[model samples]
Target chain A: MLTAIREKVLAGKRISDEDAMYLFASDDIFTLGALASHVAYRKNGRKAFFIRNRHVNPTNICVNRCKFCAFSRSQGQEGAFELTIDDIIGKLGKGQATKAKGMGKSRSPRSVHVSPHGFSEVHIVGGLHPDWPFEHYRNMLSAIRKRFPKLHIKAFTAVEIDYFSRISGRSLEDVLRALKQSGLGSMPGGGAEIFREEIRNRLCPEKIPGERWLEVMETAHRVGIRTNATMLYGHVEDLADRVDHLSRLRRLQDRTKGFQAFIPLAYHPKNTEIEGSYTSGIDDLKTMAVSRIFLDNFDHVKAYWIMLGEKISQLALLFGADDIDGTIIEEKITHSAGGLSGEKLTAGQLVNLIQKAGKVAVERDSFYKTVRVYP
Target chain B: MITQEDNSRISRKEALSLFKNADLLGLGMWADMARKGLHPEEICTFVVDRNINYTNVCINKCTFCAFWRDADDADAYLLDRETIFGKIEEAIAMGGTQILLQGGLHPNLDISFYVDLLRSVKERFDINVHGFSPPEICYIADASDLTIRETLSILKSAGLDSIPGGGAEILSDRVREVLSPKKIKSSRWLEVMEAAHRLGMRTTATMMFGSIETPEDIITHLDAIRQLQDRTGGFTAFIPWTFQPGNTELEETGRVERTKGRTARTSKLRVQSPATAVEYLRVLAISRIYLDNVDNIQASWVTQGLKTAQVALRFGANDFGSTMIEENVVAAAGVSYAVSTNDIIGAIRTAGFVPAQRDTHYNLLRFF
Candidate 1:
């Protein structure tokens, strides 16, 4: 069966779901990687891309308690805290002069530009705080955008967007439009824990359904906002479920051509309610390679080094992964879920890892614009 | 003939076999190993230069060129000395160390025209004059009724520092006959380069692939450069660029010949597909392994964009070619990828190497 699949691949035919299932079940990791590497080279040669961005999760309090999440806390939990707008501004390098300017803050004359960290984008996602109004979210984005007018703000996931719509008594489009007006540049690919209904029900029952997530993504695409697609694999999902998830993403890309990348998040099983071990490195590599093979129309495949360790991320370069997310200044979501990768990597360190993998490293912005290509 | 072994010089047959059946990743790894072995100081280099096409008027209307114009065309242009000097001044202001002076094979330009141009530029600027490919030199020699050596000597005395390898499209005469028959014969191009090398001038070797050339023909091209470099050791780098078919005579005539009532046989001569990125990297790696005598392999960012050119560093390229302050020929071919000095430095750093600015003779100017 593997031979048949390889033959089809070499003959320039698309691999069927059965072929993907067979590949998933195969024990020969080297052959699977080689097959996927052939496709990877066909798409992009020996180049792997990274970005220089900061991760800013604004709040950690949520209403729904998903089984696989360890980052959220109840309203008064010890570690649960929402950053005040001033706190967020302070983090962005505006000192205490503007801290007294209450909640009704207009874009002030851009205060002392402190740390030019060379960040091209800011990745913003957080828990759905029950008390804060939608206006708080809007103001947060607006303030951040005003502070760093040049940085691309990839804020909010589909799940958060859906929650905001329900809270604000508006349609999804209105909520997205309001956020866009507040300077939302794009959407992140999170809260998409395996698209299988059964698995989604078992893992994150109170979260948005898989269908609603797709609908929100389609609506975002219709409004000319591109987003990255993701699948949280290595959990209870079967091989068939994984293949189906990739196939659906591929079809969506066919219609919209808006997905910039497909990231297969490795499910870490340390602090969540799930009672199993972490997925092995073999499973992670195979998942990444299979996603690259399946999502042919998708322009990029990202191996979030925060989920997969630096070593595995380097190996993923040869296994059909072209992007190893970025510096991610302070990543909390992955670390809270028992991901042991560091909270940050220097641009120099990331470039070294990519170069050590014998691939050229390119630093990109959040929108996949080439910041630089390190030859 | 070179010997084929694990520790000896690679033979032509072994190199050809690598082109045919070597594993792509393994071949890339070996080529990169060879690059690191040759350039042990972890640095990638580029020159800040402008491709100054002095004129676009040409008599030999090669089918692959979109930058040429007839002498009588309304839009035809020949830059005057003032404009040329102004461009050089701008390039110097932008920290350019060299000017790649090339133009079409103009019908009536005598040797004195080139010598005077070289003299005026040298008199005004303290930059390197890397001018004239072999075909252009041949045209000038024929027009002036001088031998190739006399032509190169005269140009050298007039401040022509080096030569560019533009006309060696493919060293296989069979492919050259179909691709650029009117330009120059393969042997004549090699002869001109040999004459330049004998005059103690350094030159670069280039191969414009992805045309109607076979893998065997590509190997033959690399062999020609390798043998020449073995004899003269004057070739500084090897650059391989894809033949962009957009806005070319090939695309224009091949697509509309039938509409113009030409026979179907004429359209059959078209190159149907542009070479894909995978093909580009594969051949690029193979060229690095085959052209062992050439010290540098340059990535063509003008033909392949920044991303693939970045990837070329891993596939055995050690040079970013140039910052290309001003380029007209490849832009005329309808493929334009521009990069600044900072972009080149950033790309080189991202590729895990220090970036250095160099002169036309591969002399290190500065490291960024």
Candidate 2:
């Protein structure tokens, strides 16, 4: 029944709620893959996408002690530190240093993977600095834009915005407007852990509550910023939680086609108060495929290898994912938590991976712009 | 070569049929019935080493996890090198051969941290430093500002033995989006894996299923692993585990009211259940039966415990997984499934199969 419903849905047929449930719960993993694959083929075709962006997590400082975080620095600790605005700009300015160093230039000298297409977007996210107010972000965004106006900037998670609004004593709308005028392109889909509050109360402790997280995203969509959605898996969540996470994203997308993609974050349980076995590789794949099946309203599903590791990320392509994210020249987020994937990728390397997975690789911008097509 | 040609034109239905009735080829009744071909001893083996992820103070607070420390959290920590050194030093003393050392994407650490650790382990003791998944590799490459090849080279020079294939969920982007909105994607993951294989690092392929995927998607994951194996023969074994939902963000997202009777809907465990013996059978049988390019399919007695793991053997599984000695990840998910080498031998023997100890690559450790 679920298989038939999946076939009907993929054939441009509308499926009921019961049907959706059956489709997601089917025992046949291949059937899941096939339905998700068909949907992927219809939406994005054979094109796999990545981008040439730099992750600008300038400060690892944060006040929230969300249980799911393996990254972030306290106000002052052994390695606790913050990137000065100059330091932040200096990092982004390395796009030029990147050029000078030959990041994209095949014969260039810089040691990172330089894509054929140069950096197209700058991912601007940082821990919500307890001291820095909304204006601080304004100044930061202004400085970044003043320096690299051409680069589209996608910054701030829902949690950050919620915090920013409270700090600035304004509404989310006012804050979003101010940030946008200052050149905020879109939002990053962080803070939407599992939508179930029971887990949220226990795990996240202090994130924007599940509803507020969606409220922010839906609000952002209303204001015209296409954001992405995400679900952290493999630890402390049930399949229903997984389904509900997708269901929320799907419903929101139904109202405001704002989510450009979905990402499955694999939980790596290292260095936290909550100690447990991490999600197995099998669990990760199941999450990825099910996300694809449930999130029919979303356009693209990304398999971020930075967390999933490489082999499973590659395997994700067959399950339902289409975009492989970008080659971040220098990423700051993963390292603080003991990240293993070095913070950059090149066009050549990206091409090889997509091809190796039997797909075409393309570089994309923040708004899902086609920057370079390696296929 | 001929099989490749055949596979090129094989229909999905034909491939699906293998999930049901394909011959397991090497280790079970069919291997005995047919003229003896590939010997089990010759095939690469999988290990039972405990994956000791000592820290979760990751800079990469990816969206899919719920088990990491907020840098400011009182619970955040980093293990003293002594504890780590002791962890491995003891594992080796207890007949363990490898250590899978993967941490969250951390920041501020440099090459020296990893190199020093690798060197200390290599010089003081002789063990395979099968640590650092590709995501970790990506982090290393970014921090040192070296190409992945360059970082891998430095690690190799510093006595890095091999790579542990972890963090690979599904390679598909559609799946990746809902899971982790901010990490590396399918392409980069594969790129790093391929680069490692090219750089002479042996890796394993794994799939974490049941929480949010389909059976066909499961096949796709296996197929992806098989393709890479065909190309590099770098993967030593294939491992499949069910999702364990405990304190993750995904768990907090949605819920449905539960009812006692098995009516229209029933509340179920989040990850795939190991108790579904038939499901495990089909998956195990299909893995051994279909992943023609792969050599060993590990029995996840760790996830399934010993009994189902024993059942997996007849379902085409050959090797019993870890003596783990010590495991932190699965234990976090509320599973206390642990077994000693002697217990494993007894289980395998009880299941009517020979028990043997093997190395990281399935080579017999002088036969049991």
Candidate 3:
């Protein structure tokens, strides 16, 4: 049965939900590996990839107390932080330069003031705060882009957008339009749990509904801003639910064609509303390979270093995944949730991870432009 | 395969048969080399490193892990600075070399916190700073409002040796979306690691599989790793393990509900036992054989433990991974396995190979 599924996958046939179950239960590990290999070969070649960018987490104070959260605060938390526009830029330059130092001690002293190539993008995302109006977002984004026009600004996840729209008394369309006009270049696909309401209901009760989040992404895509999609796993969600999540994303991508990458998030389960969950390293690898097989529309499968730690991310390269998202200057959402993914990694370190995996490391822009080849 | 009795291991004919199906053959003369080495290398190994999760009270709480808690949790804590130093000291005194230093995605711990921690360790003893897994880096970035590179730079500058190759579970958005939905997905992980590699930090790689995927999925994981390895020659090794599902909500009552809590954790260790671990060993060997580019094939005594780990040597593993001073993640999964340098050397000697201490790049530091 597993071989049949493998055959189907190798033949480029879309694997149905039923086929996944049979493959899961069967004992044909090699055949399944072969099919996955076939898929990888047919699509993404062996390329260790990273994005040269930074995450600009605008605020940590949020209204939605989702089950899986270690970063969100109710505004009264002792250590809650919200990066002002200046603070965000400050973080970016410092973050990138810091990463560059890892590339070499000499790399820094020469270009500390100007920052040669450390920080990547100003990844602007934050908690879904009702208090912060659209103007706040506009100001933050406009300031960052205006200051660092060369830097790609990937701002706001679909869930945050939904939150902002409802609070701003604006439609999702209006919200996106305003943000786009305010220089929101792209969307970061966060707050997307399983598309199935069953899983989302139990795991994240207060966040946007499954369909609404997709609708927001669709709108962003329609508005000409490319975004990435992500799935939070290792929680209450099931295999079928995971499959449905990917299938749904695939369905949407078949229409909008907006998603630049598909990132499978490894649950941290550290300090969140939901309790008791963890994903094994093996599970992390398998999920990535499955995402490559399942999400046919996505061009890149990112092994974000922040969540899945470098070791698993390095191993992730072999599982049909291609892209690793850019360096994050200051990522708050996950960190606040009790994850120890990493303090941060430099481009040099990323190249090292890929080299250890025996793949070529390529730096890409937010728009998926290949920037530089490390080796 | 070098042994005559191992003729039953794999045939060149079988390897040739696999070449067309396996993607490794398409690159360079890997097929020819693999043909000589019996395709798939058929041997893989892992290293045993202590997880020493110093503290569970983290500020960065992305939604995919269950190993941490608030500082107030009954089990939450911050290992006394002395205690952390003492653990490494003890490991070093006992012949440990590598220390996987990681903590909760703590947000309040600023640049000075790590600088102080790293300086303390560097001053205390000579140990490889296999610390600051990427998530920790991202958390530090967020806490300090620095980019990953900036965080890495500060850490590296402060006697921070190398980054631990932890946290990278998968490199696909679909899987990350459902699993960690909020945590930086696959790409961010890759981005940071690449940045570090460019910075000259020799890191390692790893993968956790079997939770929510098909076999084809595993290949995708391999593809992602392979691609990165082709770029910067910074990563030193790759380790893969199964998720420990004890306190985890899904495994507790899911389809495998029959699995008892604590007891099942032990069984899960065996899930990657000598047999499975050896299969992975073969895979590791195959990785080396395939990635002629990569040099070391490590034995994972950490996840598989000492006994089975020793057996990995004959299966094609070369390096006896790290002499971890403390390990916590696997312990969280409930595996009680820790070994000092003496233990590693003893294991290697028993396995008929000489033991050698090595740095992040696998360059032999000294063989006692």
Candidate 1 differs from the real structure by a C-alpha RMSD in angstroms, to one decimal, of 17.7
- Compared with the true structure, what per-residue lDDT tens digits does model 2 show for residues A224-255? 88788888776788767777777778888999
Candidate 3 residue spans exceeding 4 A from truth: A24-30, A95-117, A338-340, B1-368
State the TM-score for model 1. 0.58
Model 2 bad stretches (over 4 Å)? A14-27, A98-118, A338-340, B1-368
Error of 1 at A358 (Å): 20
Candidate 1 vs 3: which has more TM-score: 1
**i-RMS, every candidate?**
12.1, 12.1, 10.7
lDDT of 1 by residue, B173-273 (tens): 88876666688898898999988999999999899988788888998888888888889998999999888887665663443321222334335447544
lDDT of 3 by residue, A1-375 (tens): 665766678678888767765554443333444455457667656666786666666777888777778877788788777767687767765654454444454544555454434655667777776577778888987877777666667888898888778778899989998988888778888889777888877877888888998999999999898999999987887788887888889899999999999999988766777766446554666677778777766788888867876555665676666776655655666776655455566666677667645577887777777777777
- Docking quality class, candidate 1: incorrect
TM-score for predicted model 2 compared with the true structure: 0.57
Instruction: State candidate 3's TM-score.
Output: 0.56
Chain B alone vs. reference chain B, TM-score for every model: 0.95, 0.82, 0.75
